[model samples]
Target chain A: MTEYAGPLPTPTIDTAPFWEHCRKHELRMQKCLDCGHVRYPASVICPKCYSENSEWASMSGKGTIYSWVVFHQAYGAFFAGIVPYAVAIVELAEGPRMLTNIIACPLDEIDIGMPVEVAFEDITAEFALPKFRPLGKP
Target chain B: MGSLGDKYAIVGVGHTKLGKVPGVSSIGFNVLAIKAALEDAGLTREDVDGVLVKYPTSGFSSLFSGKLCQALGITNKLMAVIDLAGATIGTMVQYAAMAIDAGLATTVVCSYGDNPLTGPPGTYGRVNSDDAAFGFVGAPAGYAMAARRHMKEYGTTSEQLGAIAVAFRKHASMNRNAQMQKPITLEDHQRSRWVVEPFHLLDCCLVSDGGAAVVVTSAERAKTLNKKPVYVMGWGQAHPAWDIAQRESLTVTGAKRSGEMAFKMAGVSPKDIDLAEIYDCFTYTALVTLEDYGFCKKGEGGSFVQNGRIELGGELPCNTAGGLLSESGMPGMLLLVEAVRQLRGECGPRQVNNAEIAIASSQGGILTTHATLILRR
Candidate 1:
């Protein structure tokens, strides 16, 4: 795992479970029990059906790059050394999209619609970030 | 359905010197802008009975419109603190007009101010998402991602985006209050440093320290004010989705619905608008908004902006006061101020000839929220 100095996210009551799953390298998300709808960032109610009944389901950890950008400038000291890194919106196979960093691939090679899979990077002792690497990478 | 159209008019507009005004707090800018707006209307603090402010609200700060009213030493019976981000100003005007129509207050003042440049950078309001943990830093990166998607879907070229900056810079050279007055060609835009991929340094707006305010009153009472009344012909506000990454289409913006509402209410079309004070936080933003607002078909904004179609005296002039690109970046209220000035025939050299009808579209939060207004003489 690469060392990270960026600010860590504080888990909320609704989102703590997702982070807990991430720490174990298991990708999980809330699925609406009433409508079989899936949601990201762990919401209590379904956006499509407004159903309060939900359950956590493990994801396949597969997604496609919907869009990406290369940050040439760093807004903080932690990113100074990582200038020109790629951040992308990856659309998971289950229908929800997430903002994540594309790793293990050259920044110039990242493009929309490229297949990718999640890789766990333990940035801290208590938390591990779910980053994406190009499919088939070792 | 009843409408607030033609019932209210912008009687006065005021702005402080934009770009790097030291020793001014955020609240101080509001007071300065309000006082100037009142003075421009030939009125006093007592004449203002309603107040609306944007920013430092909605988890940003404890300060609200009531506090701003207290700071200005005025007792307003009707006041609100709107937190729609860049759409704050555009939405504020709508609420002010509704307040007037509802007999809530006679005269309303809408204002906003921030010292993002002179004070701490990134102090301006931005969407706080979990994406921040993934190094999604600020508005530039979020907007850049959308621009990239647009390029992929529509084949939008960097040069087409550059044309927007060049047009705004050319207009800014004619205005004294513009931060960047020197003309920049497409080459100049291409040669500038990249802030993020697909966005050059010139493509971004100036981080400015300033404030702007406008007075809204009934058209019946505006005849007694000091300036010519710019009637609010039509206005609308919309939020497609708050989350930028989850929008159905990256290129489509809230202006799609908001602009439609405004035009339908005004009984006008895109061809009827003589000038467009559309938000230009970035060059691509203007292009996308132009398409979403029906200025052109979708994916044709790149071509619609080329060949000086948006320059002064073109088929449709945009950013007449250089907009946020060349003027101050105090959000979209400045666009309202410039639109009113153009309709009143006050803009000296950068004025669009016989600009009787104008449209100003303001967006906030990575194109999440939008407000459109059609103002006429």
Candidate 2:
């Protein structure tokens, strides 16, 4: 197992639920009750309707690549072993985008609009990060 | 609203010798840059009744402006600190103008200084985020994603992106104060190592240690100052989104709105401006801003930068002082200083010919915050 040495998420009140869901290997996002809009990074109030009424909805775990980058250099000591890895922003089918790693695909093969599904990687004893791998691909 | 009515002008501009200075403390650079700007305006510290200081990446104090004012022994009625990241400088100018307009103060001094080279290697401790865990480390990665999207959407090519670095280096070669004075060919940019995909090392701004400051006062008062007044024809700022993932569109920026407001306020269009001092943390930043600021049709930034159009003496010369890429990376305020200097006919070798009106646009965060300013002689 590759040690996840990068920074860990410190769950604030607004973001704790999102991480808690990830620990259970569930892709969850905040959906506004007022405007039926989905938001990310887990905010308290709805960005669309400014309503405080919101609920957590389990995601379909399906999305497409919007954009991506391959790190040629390690930005920190923990990430030194993971040079040349791809970091991508995945646009969920529900219209919210989240940052994740595109796994199970060769670095040279990743392309915009590639379909991917959520896969949980146990980074820490208490937390499992939701990463992505190409759907229906080994 | 009506061309700012000659209401405020940048009376003076000053910059500390940009690049690494071994022992200068962060605040140490601030004091030096502020003193130099005060000297350029031929006024003592006492003449400044308002102060604004851009928060440094390190050693950012909540009372930054107050501390600077205290160091100079000047009592300022309006003192503020802004943390717009790279866009702080341009925003400082906008807010300072507002302060004078509202009678909070008369002469406002906005200053920024930092020693990032002496700070941590990447400028801060590791950023804690889910994205950071995935090696989405810093500005380069975020910008690379944006560039990749631009390429996929608009067919922008690496050659077109490299043209920005080559042109800015050509301009920087003529600027004695520029950090990278050696001119680079397009081949040099193409061959440079990749910091992140779609962005070569040459495409990024320099990580330097230096300071910059500017003095803003009413045009009536500025005309009596020692230096020629560079009038603030108009200014506007917009922050459509803070996070990169949340932005409505990667290809557009808040500049779409901010630039429109600024041009309307300046009573000028992109065609009327003679030059642009755009924020170029990365070459793509300048390219995208040019598009959003109405310099070119959307998605044509790649083509607009081709064939030396952005080089010195080219039509609508940009980043005439080499910008952050080849110039010092004191963030975006230095662009304002360069715009003022260019309007004053002070840049000896890199001066834009007959430069009457100039625009300085800045982007902060991951193409998040934006500010636009129009200046005229």
Candidate 3:
């Protein structure tokens, strides 16, 4: 019930729908109509095909941990209490990467290539951050 | 030799007293560095026609380099700011040569200065909106992830990273002006506290208040100057241009292509060089960049740096002035400055023996951008 004191992404004209979809607990990426390259941090054109035509496509939000780090030190004030937290680069099943947090897991339990699925954290009334958790087993 | 190779040369190099220079401002550092460099080149402020600056880390302005010109009380035919983060220094030199080559300017001074040590609070921990929401705020988090991945992929131990810290600190002990003069061992590296997982305090570069500058001119003009000219043998730049998440492989960096471009232009290979002034933003960076430059095989950096091979008398003396690890962490400017000094035999204690050619590398944005400058005396 407390307000989110940490930083949040300010939606741009192009990135608006991505966040809008997140608020609805639906993870969507901008997919190129020409080459079908799904991209994050939504852009006007697809990096692979350079096509202006695109769609807000749905994602399974299931991914394997490509890489991760445990932050022993927090640089900002709000994060001071969380001395040790894990931020991971998730390789989505749909073929795009997301910079996100892996929640519902201990630090020692995380590893590269670990299967995970998306779980939403409603940090604020207006925004819901998409996090990940261990899928079933190690 | 590559086109435009050996065509330009660095005539002078100078730096402000590094390590906790508390009272001077960033701009003050730049001006002092320029004055010292000009004196080294036996030239006056009037001799400078172009000025390229890597804008101060602590401030921003529309005409930042122009502001530097105004501070020096001179008009420049060409002036601009370069912003490639740690790669700014090498980029500045390249831009200066191109400007001079096109007849836009004759003599150019490239410089960078920062006062983060004495700057206002929150300088080191400014809020980055992109990753801050995920309980990450500092610069180390991004690199920590990279270091961890390297560890997983190559079986690179924390001890392997410790070797890099040890070598650089040993070199620092010989450098009188280096920030961290006390030599530390691999055990000492292990004893240091962790700022981020997979990264010890010693694994990071020293933060300091300092400035460094170099004077660049045509090779012909450089020969006429007061001191020996460090010929600009070759230069090249490359950028991944993607965030860490989007990159195909986090373990690799652009240093591979950039180093090749420079070596081709300089008509040399990695083994042809005698010294390497690599940017050590993190211990991981030093290891990975050397690997990317073909100094050693991929995943072999940890072992390649194990012995005294990178030391002063070793196969390839690297970071002879301690680099960003023990030297002032002013991005990559000081690396090139040290390369210039080593080629000129200006370094008394830490100088490499009979140094002929050197490669100065600059890295920016979490291993995303890279620039390489090859120099020879």
Candidate 4:
């Protein structure tokens, strides 16, 4: 199999826990203490309530494909081998959306509102990306 | 707003040449545009009391801001660098006006400069984590997705999208400074290759290396300037959703919020707008913005452009200076300069006759951020 090697963002202090959970093969998002709102891309405070009291909670990793596109060109050399991959914005049941690549499925099968479940790919020592596949498929 | 309608004005504007000028440096182009703007305003460097630098794609810090001031030989002045992405240029005008309104500075210069084409390619890195994995790479791909969605949802045709390019090219042919003035036909646009599905090569904007600057000052101070003063009548901004996936609707935009706010502030409705300089990063951007701005109903942008509403002699003469699609894309700063020129009656062949009120709306960061400004003569 081809290896994935490219520059990855170093998780900062505020975002370290989220990356840690990703390493553990689980997707964790921040939930506001005051409003009970779930958010993504971990921030210092809740955007809704401005409350700093928040914690990382494990999500069910189930969502609908909100929108997607099939890329016919390679954006970079690292992904040049993976042309015609589907990138989708999944609206998680927890209320926040995440951008991720859909794998383990045919590109023609991808459709908006298709039910999906999280699948992890251990790409590197420090990172295990959270990709998605159809709910019942391998 | 204040009682000064048609009072506070843009007296001077300067723009660096477009396209790959690898011989020039980033800071060099910035300082050059600043000096040219100051000269255009008929003011010496010493007369500048405040500076607002909008560096969208650069590392703008207090040190850099101070370095620009020192290089321009302007000392003992208040300076700030505003980074608002695509709206950086239009927001500079609003920020300068606020400074004058609050009596913080008498004369202010807002400028942006860069050689996006000639610089080391791919230096900015991937904008998002998923972009690299799925090949949704740059702005073109991001926008191409939106265009596809718009067509899928509203029955918008590719030919209608090409009409925007056609209208802009017609206007660009009249502008000497426009980088891509060569005329193109609808067949030509369709024959062009595809960067993304449903969006051909002509639907994308050309990357150019250029800089543009504008001078904003108090109403009373502008009267004494040599050039015609294009008044800053109103301004507004809005952020619909930072992430495109989470937006309420993909076909619409947050420009409606900003455009409504600007119209209310200016006390003028859409019918009162004589001309417009909309941000056309892609043809769909302008089409969606037009609908969102209340110029046309939602899902009617394709038909609106087909009827020649955005052409030179049409009801609303839009992108008369040949938008970013046809003109040089100076990170959207030129939109403001072109709007000011149209209101001042300086656009020779593309000028809209009896143009009194003008509007310029800029969309930045994949429709994540937007800013609008109203100018009056």
The prediction achieving the highest DockQ against the true structure is 2
Error of 1 at B303 (Å): 0.9
Off by over 4 Å in 2: A1-4, B1-5, B120-125
Per-prediction share of native contacts kept: 0.64, 0.74, 0.72, 0.16
Q: Please give the distance, in angstroms, between residue B182's alpha carbon in candidate 3 and its true position after superposition.
A: 0.8
Q: What CAPRI grade goes to candidate 4?
A: acceptable
Q: Write the per-residue lDDT of candidate 1 for residues B1-377, one digit (tens) a residue.
A: 58778889999889888988988877888899988888888888888889999984212366467778898898737888887888888998899988877778889999998777666545444424467678787668878888999999999999999999999999989989888889999999999988888788888988788889999999999998898999999998998755766788889889999999999999899999999999999999999999998999999999999999999989999999898999887788889999999999999988788888999999888888899999998
CA error at residue B220 for candidate 3, angstroms? 0.8
User: lDDT by residue for model 2 over B179-271, one digit each (tens)?
Assistant: 899989889988999889878898899978988899999999998999999998888898876578767789998888999999988889999
Q: Which candidate is the best by lDDT?
A: 1
Selected candidate, larger DockQ, 1 vs 4 = 1
Report every candidate's CA lDDT. Answer: 0.88, 0.86, 0.87, 0.80
User: In candidate 4 chain B, what residue range of length 10 has the lowest lDDT sum?
Assistant: B127-136
Deviation (Å) of B156 in candidate 1: 0.3
Error of 1 at B112 (Å): 0.8
Candidate 1, overall lDDT?
Answer: 0.88
- What TM-score does chain B get in every candidate? 0.96, 0.97, 0.97, 0.94
Cα deviation at B377, candidate 2, in Å, is: 0.6
RMSD versus native structure for model 1: 1.8
**Interface RMSD, every prediction, one decimal place:** 2.3, 1.4, 1.4, 3.2
Per-prediction TM-score, please? Answer: 0.97, 0.97, 0.97, 0.91
Clashes of 1: 0
